[model samples]
Target: MEIKVSLIISVFNGEKYLRECLDSVIRQTLKEIEVICLNDGSTDKSKEILAEYSKDSRFKIINQENIGLGASRNKGMELAKGEYIAFLDADDWLVDNALETAYNEAKNKNTDITMFQMINYKENTGEEKKNDWFNLDKFDKRFKDTVFNYQQTKEFLFHLSVSACQKIYKRSYLERINAKFPEGIYFEDAPFFFNIWLRANRISIIKEYLYYRRSHENSITAKCDEKFFDVIPSGEEFFKIFVETGNYEIYKEELINFAINAYRLTLNSITEDAVEEFYKRSKRQFKKIVNSPYIEDFKKYMSKGNQDTFNNVLNSKDYEEFKKLNVNSKGNF
Candidate 1:
């Protein structure tokens, strides 16, 4: 019984949404799917829930000490015997029949990766928002059905999704590139995904929102971890991979823009108590970028506002005043 799609789910104390998440995978129309779950030392009843469903046979569960999300996914990938791979967070669920469509498209097109969209669902208010990583508006109508890597240059990089969960990856392609998520880091997907997109020669974009990415205050996405400024390391890896692949000079502009946004995102989200320390660390990161070869070229490609902000930060090193400006704009500049 060969697996067509190995859906890897990484969980840690995710009891509240665990049942619904498992239900979605178990009910997927794609019968050849295998759900590989990593129970990363969850103290909650998550392990109990997993045991309840282990009889499904297709569900493979790994109970391990608390490893971060990246390591959990990596362990599941090692155990996966599927031809295609998909990722699902423990708190997120998939659309019924979504697997069938994505799998068929990947197989039929022989794509290295099948990219899809997600519905950003507000758990509290039930508000839905678009999470189209492909930015379909930029798609040339003639190439809609074509393999993107063949039709577009790294131009498609402009809308690349840093999150890995929304896409279906060909197992062989991943193995060939020796691509594995870096473990023990928050937001590990950014660098892992950047490398995948660089190595993926053929990608198919499906416009459907096949996954529901739930939003909640408890989610660490909006929190700054004093334990680790994962983005600084991730962003550095982002740039290193590009330069190593000889794409730094070619896609320099888009890459720089992505870096700026990445930096700003983390800097803006830091908790007030941790701001001083985080700012020092972030300042070093910015200086590294500014000193990179051909970095002066980066300023020209930056959006006017971003350019000015970077200049101000480089000159004044005043994250405090920058915070004041953001406060004035109601926190989104």
Candidate 2:
């Protein structure tokens, strides 16, 4: 059977929600899909749960030592055999028609990429909310139901969500571009996302919310540990893509805005114990930006508020001084 979509689920100690995740795949309305589960050294019943689902001929499980989500995804891409590739976190599940709808849209439109909406599901409260980031209404009405590229939607570039799970890519397109997640990083999606969207020739969107993203304390996103620092290197790699592709100068302003916003969010989220180190590294990154050849452009495009924060970060002698300045400027610590 020709596989229309290869759904890769990266698992690591996700036993609690493993069944639901696997069940959703097996029950997908599209039967011509392959489920490739990368078990990244899960110590819990995750392996056993995968074994149970492996009975389905469409399901395949590959076991390996813990290499993190990014590497596992890359490995899954290598093993995938389908016209299109999709991703699913082991802790998340899909609506019954996700693959069917996304695959049909891509195939019919002959698009290089197809994106859909995601619903955030809170584990503790069982609250479900539509993720506004994926809302396509923000784009111009003319772009709807038609194939387009980043250049056409460049004005709303930063508005696009970076979550890999929210989209599907043509296997040939990904291979042609050598697309792969950045291994050993917490924000791998950022680099992978920027690379694809910036280069894709044809992209489409499905307004339906087909994926459910679970929110829990144990998730990497909820933690504020050493891994949070990974954002620095990730952001560096992200900007490098634009430079290598000669799109840096064209999208410089939007890119800088993205970096500033990302840094600010990270600063606010870092744990107290790690905040100092994060602040130091962030300051170094901002200094590099300030020293770049595009400093004038940065100054021209950056908002007054962001400029003040950037200067404060560079002028402060240390994290303490930065904190004091920040508290005074924002009226809070």
Name the best candidate (by lDDT): 2
Q: Which stretches of candidate 1 lie over 4 Å from their true place?
A: 131-137, 150-153, 224-228, 299-304, 317-333
Q: Give the TM-score of each candidate.
A: 0.89, 0.95
RMSD to native, candidate 1: 3.0
Clashes of each: 0, 0
lDDT of 2 by residue, 57-174 (tens): 9999898899999999999999999999999999999999999999999999999999888888999999997645866555666767889887887778788889999998999999
- Clashing residue pairs, candidate 2? none
Global lDDT of each candidate: 0.79, 0.88
Q: Write the per-residue lDDT of candidate 1 for residues 181-263, one digit (tens) a residue.
A: 88777768888887888777888878777888888866767456674477777778878888877777888888877777765
Compared with the true structure, model 2 gives a TM-score of 0.95
lDDT score of model 2? 0.88
Question: Which residue pairs overlap in candidate 1's backbone?
Answer: none
